[model samples]
Target: MKSIDVLLAVLANGWVVSAVLWKDSISRNTTDILRKRYRDEKTQKFSTVFNSRKPSLTSNPASKPFYITLPLDHFTTSNTDTFQSRYYVQDSYYQPGGPVIFHDIGESSIERYAPGLVDEEEFTVSMAKRFNGLLILFEHRFYGESAPLTEVSRALGDASKEGLTAFFKYLTIEQALEDVVVFANNFTYDFQSYPSQKLTPEYTPWVYVGVSYSGARGAWLAKRNPGLFKATLASSAPVELKVDFWEYFVAIEANLAASGNTNCSADLAAAAAWLSQAWETQNETLVDKLIDTVYQADWENYISQFRNQDDPRIWDTRRDYMQDAAWTAFADFQYYGVQGGTLGKFCDIMETAYSDNAPAEGLFATESLDRAVAGYTKAVAAINPYSYSRSARNKAKLKQKRQSSKLDSSLDDYAWLWQVCSEFGAFQVANTSRPQNMLPSFINVAAQIDQCIGTFGESDQVSLAGPNVSPINQKYLGWNIELSNTLWTNGEFDPWRALSIDSTTEDAPTNDTSTTEIPQCGTTFPRGTQLRYVIVDGYHGSEFSEDVVENADDIGLNPTNTIGGISASRRVTLTSTGTGTPVADARNAQSLWFNAMSTWLPCGTQVFTFTSPQPSSSTPFKTRSSYSTDGPSTDGSTTEGLTTDGSTTSNPSRQSSSPSENKTQSAASLVLPPLMNLFMLSLFAFLTGVGFIL
Candidate 1:
């Protein structure tokens, strides 16, 4: 495979953009972007299953897939044209009038992983079980089995001028958001050929939750359509659309230097400086020890073919860049952490090698130099364990290309690369002026722009310019997102945190300066909808992980507080600094989020009030068991004499025999039209009335 292909494969395999730069060094625990399969503790693989919604009478029911038909173009004259998009549902814990949690699938394949979101020990599942709610996962358009085009050949076969343009015309972030709104509305009330869900008296409440890129979508979706989506839990979401995102590397280096080893960081920095000097001096022996000269020669030869082409995608450089490997190592350490299988051991080797050599007169003695070289080799091996295997694969692919005369293509890579080029240009480049800069100076924004253009093989067709990202920033308000009823939670160690809405920064103001207070480490702003931020001491997707409550010996902070873990890391809480609200405890985010959901959509309370009289044939519906005159009571129970308007009322003249029978009568009392379907039909009708129909 070409170097570009390898980079794109890494992008497709995970949601984090850094994954493309440091593939084998990082784990797949971040976001489920381009992953093929995931394995649990038992080694049980969760792979994608490609089956239609309906199986014939002889086929198994478990293999069935669900689909939603959406318009080809929702905003234009061709909006009447539609395509079937796939989705998955897990309703085992679904209650008739409980809350609904929708997990947004990012820019990758969504299959059996859909069910696992609610079936496993994830927080979504726990929330579902807590509220007896329904869970649904929808596939993004052009990803997984939800292809807009019928044939793979038509979608990704041709990369030539016209072919690339035609392939990505309809695949925009706006269209995907529209698709989500359509899915959310439709899934709440009806499913074709399955039991139709009743949305009556107490309409089920909906909550949107997502991590990483999807996390950004979740916040925006709720912000865009507030009434439809009641609340949002956008974990580790990057709200800003950046161009030269050098701050990302700044955060990465900070995290690495703080990785429990001060000496290791110093040695790594020294080594990077040394490599740069060697590259400039053209020290053959030193350069060969650092980078493979043969590989560099091959790269130069391959890249030279397209240099003179007037295409912006083709790079013009001929120099062999060093320290990219070191940058990758530092990135892996910051992203995955030492516990998540990163380069701590390799850093140890480096530290040992550095101490033994000591760099006398800016050069090492023969024995110590060999030891340091050996250490460097071990470290590179850890970073790119499959280096040999990858070379073999590339050679085989080249031979196959020579015979068949075709390049290996992937629509997944193309799709994501387009998004990066068009919207979030968060290209991680080195900020060399900073004191702690470790990445090589050549790995800058210009290089990333070239890569973006090169990957798509388009100059004018794709924008490496500013026009594409400006409108989005203007529309969404960038990091100063003014959406209410939205929550932003991020892990302290997540490098993407630099680009997100961090309350502590001068860039992300709370608008109320006196009230805006940044917490030390494990604290959150008082729980209100006025754009609050919480920074937890965890890795990516930490807020969404299940919190395990376990007894522990007090480590001197709070003896009775006990301890909890979100996977390997300990869970911490955010203190409530605002007046009248007490400090939160026990899985701070989970507790705060759970309380917010209950406040947003309480079970024992009626959200909507009705004035029309019930039909004569309608049975007496049972009232909720508990109610609070002031609001939600401390105890999770219902009271008698509760009315729709949240006021106390006398008992009904007639009452059902039991709660179960009353529930049945309540479900039967009033009829509800499928609002989502009706809305879609009305949309078409309005378009026809306006003479915009095809």
Candidate 2:
């Protein structure tokens, strides 16, 4: 019995020891797997991770990719002897092992608070996916999270009035460019602390992308740091240094006209004309009614179309309108038939128009409208060249025609009555006889009203009026010359900026007579600048359709095959054949573009190509071809083609002596599987371990 008991105890002890050893082994193995996936280093410190220098180019492939966001110190100068600036850092993210990095800047504060609008975050994600690169989003100083510490400086004394403007003047393009460089340099090193991977700065190239205001910044950055960034994708950016308020007004008018509201346009124009005549005659009662009618009608017919009051679009439009109006009104209120107490009365009317139906009949009823008006007025007054009265007079003459006619009599008369009451109370304070003090404000307001009415008051009018004076021409000059050397982008449809319409030709416009040109792949501009233009089917930056959004991975990973379509092999075959003539070649310029871009961009080689017959041309010219990386190509094609007839040739065959030999050595000819394999391995491991966990 004693011997048997001993044997049982020995077996139990051995099992216990084995279990303890097995648990420890499993724990270590799990930790090892995680470590391999993350590339984590147990001993690395946080500070060392954050501020590490860029990795050397030849790091191991198994290393985990680094990712980070940090602040960068940027500087800007002031007009005064004092150097006033702030420390602003761009928010950046770096994907491990990806060849490209992206940088984005935020919009102005006015753009952000506007009510019915979509933010840029969704768009940014979409673009990041499309480009398959790291994204860096930067905040403009004096806006959003980047407000300057000098707010107190503005609050000290009367200088506060000009403080914000002065501060903004210091936040110039040059300083913004410096911030981009610093961010790029730091992005390489910040990834060092990750346990599973190694990131060396030398392995990845950077691509800068911007939208709206940031688009301009992206373009300028690309120009400034050609070595740092491989390419730039700028969307809806307005980079012109000088902008006219009239352009915005005109855009609104054109938009209204395009909506096919003939009756509304006519009525609005008539009402404006009546007001102008009334102001000239000093018909205070008539003028007051006219002003009220104008506000209500404009809001109902035009402004309401922007968005619901709660909508971001509505908020943005209202904010813009108020800002523009206040600047124009305060600069010269009399131009809008406002004087003396009229300014205060106008504020009251504006408040009522914007406010909800409430018990106390709130003064400036709409808090949003009131705040917008006040803020805009303050901003405009600070920057305005002329004083109030002077601006008003200039506005009255220009807008007289538009203010005269009333649209809906009931709404017009009701608004007119309200205006009369306000004016009656305000007219008592009118010191119209004392023109000197009031004239400046009046003139400024008038100039703004004139701007709204599609007329230029004396102070607001340009002395030299011609093609040179046109806003489009002016913007082009600034973009092509002063702002060109910097990385920047201008939009084709943006009211404040203009892109070249002459994209078909290579020659940049010399004078007013020259046509503006679009940029394409293989299209080189003077001074080694390359231009690329993308034409989307819908409104600018339209989201992908539901089908596309749902099937992105399938489309990206395994595209469907079509027998008659252009494929990788077919494209190669076309290049190999070398049968098309120069004109036939000129017509196939788009195909050549696909071929060229495939050579230049690492991402481009992965894109699938489809060729459709050109609709505008006969025989061989009749076929139009289009290429897309995202999915199957849309069937129809537009008339845009690559041309050699201009300053440059579109046909690679004509441009190069030995086309067949060149095609063989072209970047497109290289096998894509090796790079794709690396991408897949990294992607699979990343998706499995990271939150994707698929």
Candidate 3:
């Protein structure tokens, strides 16, 4: 995807100005964007990547898919049936008994990681090949092609709330983790060799790496199944769970202010305040007008085209339309960071609303608050507003999209929301107690309750309880979390940091300056000195996309690719001190991980390439590419033996085939998957040309 920074100035009197040379990447971006689905297709085409015991590959092995039968219900036999979970293996680098590096792809398609398998620049591939490690992309159940239950889970025309009930029952944190454990127990990889290596963690050193929801899964799975994985690197994992997470907007507001654009945030607050005032008063005409202005002149018809049916909520959208409108610009910032175009573009629109006449004073100054409302509207018009909802229409669209086959979606909404509704109560609410809330005050626990009832058949009451998020915490000690040989990481600007070990920590985090404090991998017993990292000026999924361009001017490039290439080439700047920048820390984290992996397992170079690789400047990609018709199956074979039982096995001694002297290697390297319905509008962004999709 092509990207060029534009800096055109806008004057008052409601007019326009000239700008920079524009390059049309939308066609190319769309082409590149659409091609991403090939990863899944290619993955399924070559069902088994492992050809033979003596097979050899001079070049890096392309990632290929394998399916293993996992119990649909790990907890009980009520649904004793089984479903196939997909995993991709890139084992060309795997030497005899070398460590296994598992990059968890939770709530994402296998296609999203197609590059990580072969691209040496990616830490997953580079480090794995260096250490002669077997790199495996482990797909979490119910996401991407790993989705189970053809008829009701997601894209088989039966994804209604009633239809998805059975499927949702199988999509649980424990069940997903158990899938990993069972895979481990049954792992029969002839890892780059003859006899079945039975590459169980007992026989090999397995490293767990994941970001966002996968990050949380990595942490929780590590805890549940100890021996399955030796070292864990959970980036942007939200360990804490809660309802009414008003603090989410706190990060956005702080980030906007920190970016030296206090007025942008102020304007945002003003817009929210304006809309909230109208919403509170129930001014139908103004509300409708405000929404129409934000959407389009033909907003009603525009919305109706893609709608599943004649949704009653279109005009009187349930779950606080005002709140949804205010959050439209910001729904993705948490996932893509401050640089995600929508949020920044929204701010720009808000600023230019009256900036020409009265530099900083306009909206909220006038009697009507027209400028504030207009700014909000124009911003959404310029940039796609994240108006994803679990309303019946979206459900019908997902259920029936198979008819057109334009796109097939993972039941991300249903699966993730199930966890949130049942146990993980992380409702994105507003902190209304504050004098000026960046997010509209319309969002609160009650609003979330309406959402829960509206989506699932649950009428969970509004409880402004402690971000106690205790249900999962009680099962696993929330921030009071600890694991053996684990590396915990979070992005500084990641909104989910509020729930990760980064924000809710029982122990002080690992100081960046004092990384050496992390003990040598094997010396410590039951557990090692765990490492906690905070990516300076980083956002969700920072580690996964470390290749993004970084410099004195650009500290971060909000990648839309990770979330499906929708956000666009929004950029952020920070004074870079060669030592602690986003890219720098990302690499540093990788360095630390490599060192720890070496200490824990037998591998090629005791150290690895610290030489910097060329950075990638692709447009922001937000989620996975489109899914193929072939998702995780109820009938499939398993070479990976992918499971997460975590049960211990007799230790098998392993030796590094290409062992080398321990040398010091230089450091390098979701964010959590946001629990928002915002991702649902990615298609809208792609087709509308309002925002860059790829």
Index of the highest-lDDT prediction: 3
> Against the true structure, what is each candidate's TM-score?
0.63, 0.39, 0.67
- Error in Å for residue 344 of model 3: 2.3
RMSD of candidates 1 onward, in order: 19.6, 29.8, 17.6
Summing lDDT over every window of 10 consecutive residues in candidate 3, give the lowest-scoring window: 13-22
- Candidate 1 on 1-694: residue-level lDDT in tens? 3654543233322212222322211212233321111113262211221211221123221244466677656556534666667666556666666677787767655553553543334566666766667676666776654555433323242244346545555666677777776665555445344476654323567778777778788877655655555567777787776654556545445555565655545555555655555544544465454444323443344345553434332222112224335553543333344433234555654555545643432222323555655556556544432221222223222332232101122334456656665555565555544545555554544444445544454433344341144445555666767554455676666667766676244355555421212221223345432434454445556545433232221222221222222323543544532211121222555544554554455423223332222222110112222212233221212234433234553321111110001111011122221122222232222111111101
Whichever of 2 and 3 has more lDDT, that candidate is 3
lDDT (10s digit) by residue, model 2, range 1-694: 4543443333322222221111111111111110101111262100100111122224322122122232222331221122211121111233444434353534322111111011222333333444444444344433322333343222211122133223333333444455556545644333453444332223354555555445555655544544455455454444433211122223223433453433323322333333333334444443323222323443344333433434333332232222223333232111111212123323333333434332142322224433533432332222231323222222222222232111111111111111111110111111122211111112221222222112111111111110011222232343453322122222222222332221212233443222113233343345534333322111122111000122222222111211122233432111211111111111122222222222234432122121221222110111111111122111112122222122221110000000001111011222211111222232222111111110
**Which ranges of candidate 3 are over 4 A from the true structure?**
1-63, 77-79, 154-160, 190-195, 302-315, 318-324, 356-358, 366-368, 385-410, 459-469, 504-516, 525-529, 548-583, 602-694
* C-alpha lDDT score of every prediction, in listed order: 0.46, 0.27, 0.49
Please report how far candidate 2 places residue 158 from its true position, in Å: 7.3
> Which has the better TM-score: candidate 1, or candidate 2?
1
Q: What is candidate 2's TM-score against the reference?
A: 0.39
Model 1 misplaced regions, further than 4 Å: 1-62, 79-81, 150-158, 188-195, 199-202, 271-285, 293-324, 330-335, 354-374, 386-409, 457-461, 503-506, 510-535, 545-586, 603-694
Candidates 1 and 2: which is better by lDDT?
1
Model 2, 461: alpha-carbon shift in Å?
A: 22
